[model samples]
Target chain A: MNVMYFAWVRERIGVPQETVETEAATVNDLIAELKTREDRYAAAFADISALRVALDQELSDFDAPLAGVREVAFFPPMTGG
Target chain B: MQVRVQSEPFDAGAELNGFAQGRTDIGAVVSFTGVVRDTDGTLQEMLIEHYPGMTTSAITKIVEEAVSRWTLADALVIHRHGPLKPGEPIMMVATAAAHRAAAFAAADFLMDYLKSRAPFWKKEITDQGADWVAAKDEDEDALNRW
Candidate 1:
């Protein structure tokens, strides 16, 4: 699966884009997998409380299933105006 | 008919006039311009940063959704990224409709969605230090209530 990051989320994680191999079934499961990679990934996701996720460009909840999703993007909550 | 995400500031009146030109059916033109403000009530500067490709697509989606929900004749949205100073324009949304109500509502809806759903991030450089403005839950809740 392909994962993308944006803004400071990219900076913190040290990469803008990455292809991940996972057996995760949900967005939360994917997060768990990324958190296991390194300290940067762990810290970037340490406060998932402040993060938001989008599956295939549609805003989704953390618990949303990613069973058939092809892309997952993680970023901070939107501040655009 | 145009949606732009750039680093240059925009002129609301000029853009509105340009969009309204040669249009006989556009009776109402409504626009909203968002400006940077000093956090302390004093004149402080602000800086905005955003993802390149994602910002444009995100805002374009918001405009498309608004147009589908309303009977708008035209809509223009321009959002500036990179660094910005105090009182400088950060974003603008202009909507044209047959009546003022639809134009006004569409413009407001665009702004609401932009604040809560767009992909831009802002960093404020204060006397203390540089701080990235976190997305507020209140902003999200406001969108939810709509």
Candidate 2:
């Protein structure tokens, strides 16, 4: 799966996107998996409440299933206009 | 309906003039332009970042819904990404209908959705430092009115 980060999440994680081979069943599981890899990941995922997730380019919830999902994006709330 | 997500600047006047031009059936046209605002005057530029694959699709879906819900003759949304200086046009939405109510309501709805639902983020670069603009509760609350 391809994992992407945007805004402050991208800055905190120090990279925009990456391909991760994981057996996680949901977005939350994937975040848990990423947090163990590095301190940056832990810091970025520190507060799930402040984050938003997108599954395959659609706005989704953190508990969304990852089955058949190709991309998962994490970012702060959108501030567009 | 048309949704354009681009990096380059656009001519809002020309686009507005061209939209629904010479359409006798459409009597009302409502357009709204969002500009990069420097409220406290400590800003340098606003850097807009977006999800390339999702930006157009998300906005198109919103526009489609607006059209379906109203008697719209045409609708257009143009949003820019990348660095934009203060006073520059950031985005615009135009809606045309046979009556003023539909056009006005749809344009207002589009702006509300664009502010919160679009997959775009704004970062303000100020004289002191750069920071990501936080999404305001009022902006999210605005969606409930629709």
Candidate 3:
């Protein structure tokens, strides 16, 4: 699976995208897995309320199932237009 | 319908003039352009970032909903990403319809949705420092009015 980050989250994570192999069942589960891997991930995921998730390019909830999902993106709330 | 996402600067008036061209059935055309404003006169640049794969699809869906809700002859959306000066344009929305009401309403709806729903982020660079612009509750609340 490919995981991505954007904006300040990307700056914190230090990478835009990465391919990860995981057994996570949901977006939150994946975040938990990543948090254990590095301090940067822990810091970025510290406040989930300040972040938003997208499963396969569509806006989705943290509890959204990751079954058959190829891409997951994490970022802060959009300030577009 | 046309949707363009680019970092290059664009002329909004030219884009508006070229939109829905030579269409006899269209009686009204409405457009809205978003410009970076330096409220405190201390801003240097605005940096915009967006998701690559999702942007086109998200915007297409928004415009399609507008087309279905209103009788539009055509529509155009252009959004830019990357660092931009305070006076530069951030984005533009244009809609053409048989009636003024439909065109006006559709354009307004497009702006409201684009403000909150698009997968784009903004950072303001001022004389003091650069900071990410937080999404406003008012932007989210604006969508409810549609």
Q: After superposition, how far is residue A20 of candidate 1 from its true place, in Å?
A: 2.8
Clashes of each: 0, 0, 0
lDDT by residue for model 3 (B1-146), tens: 99999999999999998999999998999999999999999999999999989998999999999999997999999999999998899999999999999999999999999988889999999999989999888988999998
TM-score of chain B of each: 0.92, 0.98, 0.98
A best-first ranking of the candidates according to their TM-score comes to: 2, 3, 1
lDDT per residue (tens digit) for residues B11-102 in model 2: 99999999998899988999999999999999999999998978999999999999999969999999999999999999999999999999
Q: For model 1, which pairs clash?
A: none
Q: How much does each candidate deviate from the true structure in C-alpha RMSD? A: 2.4, 0.8, 1.0
The stretch of ten residues in a row with the least summed lDDT in candidate 2 chain B is: B49-58
Query: Candidate 1's residue-wise lDDT over B1-146, tens digit each?
Result: 67999898788878877986788997898889998988696445566766564677888888988887887888999999888888899989899999999998899889889998887878888777777788877887777755
Q: Which runs of model 2 end up more than 4 angstroms from their true locations?
A: none
Q: Which candidate is the best by TM-score?
A: 2
* C-alpha DockQ for predicted model 1: 0.66
**Candidate 3 Cα misplacement greater than 4 A, ranges:** none
Between which residue pairs do clashes occur in model 3? none
Every model: iRMSD: 1.7, 0.5, 0.7
